[model samples]
Target: MVLIGICKYSGGGMQLTKNPNSTDGLLDISYIKDLTLLTILNNIQSLFNGKITSHKLISTYKTSTLKINVLDNNKSYIQADGELIGSGDFLVSILPKAINFIIP
Candidate 1:
């Protein structure tokens, strides 16, 4: 499934909570903002090292939106839509299951 929004843990690297909207389950993506853009690029690249062919980033104006583009080995792509609300400190609220399909 496509996990959207920011998942926050109580301690260190804990399982993601089901209710990301809750006050306690929020994480800030801005913390990593200080990292170089190249580092971020490499980090994202590592996510689909070999399992997928390519990926496309989607742009959205909505603060509560999580847009994802799924790509396959055939060089085709598909888009998945979801909502994510920022709860301050870079935390966002995303749906539990928003995966659409892999493009091919």
Candidate 2:
């Protein structure tokens, strides 16, 4: 799993997934903890350069399923597919090709 943002509860977040093409049947997780502004910028830059997995602050992983236990009093925001969906805990499981793209 890979994480890029903060979880708030744990102070980390998920940036990318298992596969960009959604064909891998696993979730690529990226998480970074205790990142400074410079490190954040560097992470973004490295992601663009396809070197995100090499950063010291970044942790990457691959899994078919995930379970997260969230704190009751904490409020954490999750951004999925460029939209702010909701807050709090997450239990993410990847289903291969469960979605399709529609463009005009």
Give the winner by lDDT: 2
| Model 2 vs. true fold: TM | 0.64
TM-score of 1: 0.20
Each candidate's TM vs. the true structure? 0.20, 0.64
Instruction: List candidate 1 segments past 4 Å from native.
Output: 1-3, 10-62, 73-104
lDDT of 2 by residue, 1-104 (tens): 22432111112343233234344456666666676788767566555544655677667666778776656625566666557776677788866668664433
Residue 90, candidate 2: C-alpha displacement in angstroms: 1.3
Please give the lDDT score at residue 8 for candidate 1: 32
Candidate 2's clash total is 14
Per-residue CA lDDT of model 1 for 1-104, tens digit only, reads 23333433322333222333333333222112133566546655434342111223321122344433434424322222322432212224434345443334
| CA lDDT of each prediction against the hidden true structure | 0.32, 0.55
Candidate 1 displacement at residue 71 in angstroms: 2.2
RMSD of each: 14.5, 7.0
